[model samples]
Target: MKIAWLTLCAPLLLSACTSTQTVGYGPNLEPIPGSITYGGQPRTKLTKAPVGSIVPHQFFDDFGHRVYETYVIEPDRSLRLTSRRIDYDIFND
Candidate 1:
């Protein structure tokens, strides 16, 4: 019984480990006003930076909030924003 169960589960476990998740922009990944890719990816594609390399950008949003963003270069030579942080400047107000 145990041998049969292991045989049944082995392929499932190995398949799970072998699956690769593709990273790309989705509906929820809409860029903000001051983002680098806000108006869509630049006509000039990155060549020197290898795929999976991280690029950081800082800018002030339309609301005057400091925004820090981290992006990764995809296989297609496009930048994909992976993480973002906003500084509200609570004390400055």
Candidate 2:
């Protein structure tokens, strides 16, 4: 009886722990200003990088904000923007 109950509950507990939420924005999303993909998705595909690879890009935006973006290479050779971080030089660093 205990083993049967454990077996029945195990799948529910495991499924609850599995994450369905994405880490960040999905692919082909409208780019936000100061992001690397603000203009559009890059024409060059990440042919060399493997799927699920994390790529980092950094640059300064039009308003002088430093932008750092993280992307994951997809199976189709497109990049999915995962997360973006912006830092303003408030202290002139």
Candidate 3:
């Protein structure tokens, strides 16, 4: 009984250990060399848009904190994106 519960809980605990790393923009900022400014996997080097995708997306900050990266894909397939960085401290930080 205890073993079964532990087994079931192990994966959940392990998955929570996942971490995020900063993509240092200052060093690699020359138009990102090959970074797709839009139509990518939200936060990685991926180029394909997400399935059933809608725009006005989001992302994170330098410390892997939450941020919003908004984008819009027009009917004619034109892409427009903007990034807004927000810290966890809402009022004063």
Candidate 4:
């Protein structure tokens, strides 16, 4: 009887020890990539910009949806946006 009880309770105890918590951004909360800037300058890089170099930029928007833009460094040390996209929540779908 004790062996049978242990077998049944073992699964329950192991399951309880496991965590189902989610980490990082949720499905609804997505990350939007913004433009890239080097130092305090916009569309400008301190070093020579390569064709496929990436720069990081941060900004906040008033809208609820997340807005992001991606920029690629040009040979001229300038930044150009390759593409832009927006993430929004839709109801009544």
lDDT of each: 0.77, 0.70, 0.44, 0.50
1-93: candidate 3 lDDT, tens digit per residue: 999999999998876555333333222322122223533433432246653244554554445455544444444444444333344542222
Instruction: Please name the candidate that would achieve the greatest lDDT relative to the true structure.
Output: 1
Error of 4 at 58 (Å): 5.6
Clash count, one per candidate: 0, 0, 1, 0
Model 1, CA-based lDDT:
0.77
Candidate 4 residue-wise lDDT, 11-70, digit = tens: 888775433322123223333433253243364354855576865443533554444555
In model 1, which runs have C-alpha deviations exceeding 4 angstroms?
1-27
- For model 1, give the 10-residue run with minimal summed lDDT: 18-27
Ten-residue region with minimum lDDT total, candidate 2? 17-26
Question: Tens-digit lDDT track for model 2 on 1-93?
Answer: 999999999998877543233225555545567565668778888788889999888777676666677888879877678776666554443
Q: Which candidate is the best by TM-score?
A: 1
Off by over 4 Å in 3: 1-54, 82-85, 90-93
TM-score of each: 0.66, 0.59, 0.31, 0.41
lDDT of 1 at 37: 94
Can you rank all candidates by lDDT, best first? 1, 2, 4, 3
Residue 62, model 4: lDDT of 53
Off by over 4 Å in 4: 1-44, 56-59, 90-93
